[model samples]
Target chain A: MTAVPNGHDGLITARGLYLSFGAIPALVDVDIDLWPGEVLAVVGESGSGKTTLLNVLSGRVAPDAGAVLYTDPEGEQHDVHTMPAPALRTLHRSDWGFVHQDPKQNLRMNVSAGGNVGERLMARGARHYGTIRAEAIDWLTQVEIDADRVDDLPRTFSGGMLQRLQIARTLVTHPRLVFMDEPTGGLDVSVQARLLDLIRTLVARLGIAAVLVTHDIAVARLLAHRIAVMQRGRVVETGLTDQVLDDPQHAYTQLLVSSVLQV
Target chain B: MIRTEGLAKTFTLHLRGGMQLPVFSGIDLTVHSGECVVLSGPSGAGKSTLMRSLYGNYRAGAGHIWIRHHGGMVDIAASEPRIVLAVRRETLVYVSQFLRVVPRVSTLDIVADEPITRGIAPDEARDMAGSLLLRLNIPRRMHGIPPATFSGGEQQRVNVARGFIAAHPILLLDEPTASLDAENRSVVVGMIQEAKARGTAVVAICHDADVRAAIADRLYPLSPAREAA
Candidate 1:
């Protein structure tokens, strides 16, 4: 297991972040930090601005106010909101991973499974075909696919397997930070269980810092070290997973907990 | 009530070629309706092995496990496989610490499978399973995805949902709270209490003192076998 951070390192810090679209606010005065080697889940109902916060923090959407800073491995702080486009793109390609909700959206449909994974490595300047293929196969096996199927097209794989392949492709590059938006969405219960297990193992083994956005409190409780609950584009509560979920202090959080759908 | 007499189990070490490793023997226990019985022991003791034997996952070396089924006592130890499966489906439920994965199956369907098989409408079963997953903290977005990539805590919740949704007459839980956080643990305690109130018989192994204190009616201790020491 990778050495977990001692709750000191701030990999990404956002201060007084504010954003709006066409006069309506999508995020309002939000501040948070992404720590190294920890999973942080941002949870809330749809249109509560959880996704907007993720996009802003990930530099996909620029905020109108506040500053978002990212600390590189060398401890140099870069202003994410104002960073040059090329440098920001480079940062995402080499140091970060993004997993979309749909596997088809995240994976390259035309590429072979191995090619999908190898492409990530190739972007970082891996030139040797034999070495890249070997690494890709190794990663495929790690995601629970047969090594022999490395040459097969992802279109032939099941939805669950496709998601696994996408994960392998994203993580094979050893990205330091991963942003996931409903990574387990669109799968059935049985497949989701196994897939969740796999994702947990990979996240821990890689020591990847993650910001996972989900509407499910259970997903937050399971995967996140800390949770930040958002409502109407503002954070209602933030704390360790157990504390926030078990003894929620905010009225909104309390309602969310008690309102958990029952069978 | 479900009762056992002289329940014993032994494993022949396949690699060691016929050497018998006896787990436990001469065990006597009874679990009555609305009661929770907890098995307590050290790591090497046969608590889990014995629990599995009672659930018919392992063949007991010697004993009679009488389970109340259809207004009669069925000897699970000597019953045919068909009878055992029927009892498992209709009367007994087992929740293990580690989830057994059914490849490419989503988390919702896994939890809903038992209830659906028991004649619940598919939509109702899915809804119930969805609610259970929500209660267990599984995300709604994950309702349709396969479970193979879920974290340990998530997978355990799926397992718990599957076992509880069955609402069988008897429950066998092995470390059901092993991977859960304090919040989810309390949820599990509530589920257990609800099951007991419905007159379900429960046998469980829990090392967490808080959970044990919350649900156990009595403690059954198991010790490692010592050959005539």
Candidate 2:
């Protein structure tokens, strides 16, 4: 009950959030806040509810009890549990972007590179063909894609390029928050470095508040402004990125940090 | 909050038979929550254009202008107008150099309307607007008067008051203190600091060196695109 911080400028606040998969609990009285313009990394071993917290915060999964309050850009707080379906849909479409672990799962591989980016614009109601095409070119270039490959299908692209395109597609609308789950999980080390650099650059440049879920503490150390260390479906420690990584307070946190060091 | 990557903007002079004029390009910057970023550079270098692009007022020639609005990182350069409008309404709050008000609306009403639209009670909204106006030192007598007859500084104060009332996640200010006197400018600086402490991300343009130095966490110089290194 006393775990959640008080007087925080939370962009998204969860209070007593509880969820379960059948009889087994997924989240137990969890409380956290997604602050504005700061990357709050949820790091833990697998099955620690890092991804589950992400899903709950993003409104992709419903909790059995407790409430999640989301502050819209206009500063009005809405209860996520009872928010209207259309409003929730609009929130998903306009205010949030998700970068999944696999690019193929997020990208329309049969579509051309430009089409993947432009499709988001169309979803937002862009009708003029020329404007959409121009924006697609602009976004493609932003994500480091050559404009000449605008018409090339994503299926033809390499793994890293596909991830970049997926980022372009998700970010083109300038959503208020971004949810990323293991964005660089499967890439080669070199590719992961490059992609992580790009993601770091994009996240910083957009000032987009992010809730990044990762098991890799290195990734968390590299990009997160703050860290929320999860264990047994509960947050065992949370603090500024460097502080939590360097001088961990909780027993679980020290173990987690030391484990990363050992490797 | 706002982020950019290799963001570029240019103007096509159709009157000059489509003579392409490069304003600035290859720009990359980020303004974080509770942080104030001041856009600087010489005039005509597209400092305001960059701010405008973040607000979705101008289309970018190249690169991405990502804004966190509603719940997502939206690319303002490419998102549809409806999506941009939604972001503008809720997430990105912009204060232009001048005030634009509906005809015949009282200054109080104009300022009060923002919070009201955001679902605050009408009376409560008016009270908030009144206090903000008073903080900016607007005369109580003129609260009912239209801002059309106010001086440049007075109008600007009203505009600022209206913008600050929302406490939106991202704030874009264009020459916020251009018309204010020293005292009023100091008040504005304080207001900006308060906004930042509340976790509002701010990107603003200011010609005044003192004001820029006081509020800026960092300076983003928008040099001309032709000089790209």
Candidate 3:
């Protein structure tokens, strides 16, 4: 299937993606695409295969059928699942980033916050220590963390600070695409708002394409330009975030949206 | 500019056991730069539905809506969500009959919000908001206060101010002067003409014949019709 229009720049394209785990289908004939500088949110209830789809699309999980194709900013196409392990690892450390749902799962708890942010740059071959440190401090400040805490261990930071530190580390390499799984999950309301705001601002400022996996409709509405509603291993509906959420066409989507508690 | 061919819309009432309601069909409407086209007909004519569909508020059941965005023709009916958002930001804008905003947001912020989001300086955006409020006859004293407690006419003026602040290429006004008095209605009519003079294509639904005569470049009539049995 065709992705975005000709005038638009392409980022990622997936076709007929099917996967299973011991007879439990995780993705069934899934087809998705992404354009640069756009955020596409995947939303559904727990156990809907939202996370599985994200993992497969990011090349962390192998699909039983179909392929995930990514076009770099240099105008080169790379098949995500077919690349060599070192090639894929290099791609992950450089051109792509994946943000786990839990901060602890993403960060080095014992490492200094500065080191956490600088390590990605080091992997990308930023040779100058002073420059890496300066960039780390800049990223910490960008995520609203104080520069004085650059050397503090991440385990000592609050939930919000830990999440922000993880984000800073993920974004330090100037990755062209990021796959985030509930970046604001398991946080206080105010902290979630602030972190989501930072993610929104950074994503917009950097023009990074993203596939965000979230169950929160409000979060999707705030951060995503488009949305894909997953239900039991299939994307039941996909369209503009406002259009799909506002006027859901699928029956399952209608029920899912209506079930949200109104604040 | 905006153009549509064979555009149609239908609503399926889920609560009514899936009964389908066809709103309109076979409509060919076009509005060019420096022009205003008004949708004219009776109450059940689907004028509001047509306007909302054109603004990408409702998904069209059939046909194409070709809108000029970023110097290209974008069919909003079929384009992806990112493309639609770009169109709304740069080309298409809509001012509904009512003002819907966050609670306790001052009228000045409501009016200034558009340009500020478009990267205009906050102070300059506020200044533009003040001038537009004053031009709409909304007193400067009321700018800092929320429009929630204001009368319907005043609120409509705030929406008008917000809609015009960004100078988008196309505009859709739905019942802009329904609650306005004779004098303020003329003020809005004048503002609309000014926008048209600035090469803004407009599609509006105004019941007032005088207002229609004053600003309408053409009338696209839509009346309810029976479907084939």
Model 3: runs farther than 4 Å from truth?
Answer: A1-9, B13-16, B40-45, B69-73, B97-162, B175-190, B206-221, B224-229
**CA error at residue B156 for candidate 2, angstroms:** 49
Q: TM-scores for all candidates?
A: 0.55, 0.53, 0.84
Q: Residue by residue across A1-263, what tens digits does model 3's lDDT show?
A: 24543323578888889988888998998889888888999999999999999999889999999998888768887889998889889989998998988889878888999999999999998989999999999999999899999999997899989989999999999899999999888998878867876887788778888999999988998889889999989998998887787667777877877888976
User: Taking chain A of candidate 3, what TM-score results?
Assistant: 0.96
Superposed model 1: Cα runs more than 4 Å off: A1-8, B1-229
Sort by DockQ, best first: what order?
A: 3, 1, 2
Instruction: Please identify which of the two predictions, 1 or 2, would achieve the higher TM-score against the true structure.
Output: 1
Q: Using DockQ as the measure, name the better of candidate 1 and candidate 3.
A: 3
Residue-level lDDT of model 1, residues B47-157, one tens digit each, is: 998888888776678989999998899998887543676798799999998876546668898888788767788899999999999999998999898887899988998
Give the per-residue lDDT of model 2 (tens digit) for B130-192: 999999999899999989899999999999999999889899999999999999999999999
RMSD of candidates 1 onward, in order: 20.1, 21.3, 3.9
Candidate 1 lDDT, tens digit per residue, A1-263?
A: 11222233588888888988887888988988777887899998889898899899999998999988888998888889798999998998899999988888778898999999999999889999999999999999999999999989998999889989989988998999999998888888778868887887689668899999998887777777778899988998876665567545566777787789854
Q: Per-residue error at A71 for model 2, in Å?
A: 0.9
On the 0 to 100 scale, the lDDT of residue B160 in model 1 is 95
Question: Which residue pairs overlap in candidate 3's backbone?
Answer: none
Model 2 C-alpha lDDT per residue in residues A1-263, reported as the tens digit of each score? 13345333578888888888887788987888777777889998999898999988888899888888888877888887799988988888788889999999889988899999999989899999999999999988988899999999998898888999999999999887999999989888767866776787678678798999999888887788778888888887776665567546567776787776542
Q: What DockQ, between 0 and 1, does each candidate earn? A: 0.03, 0.01, 0.31
lDDT of each: 0.86, 0.84, 0.88
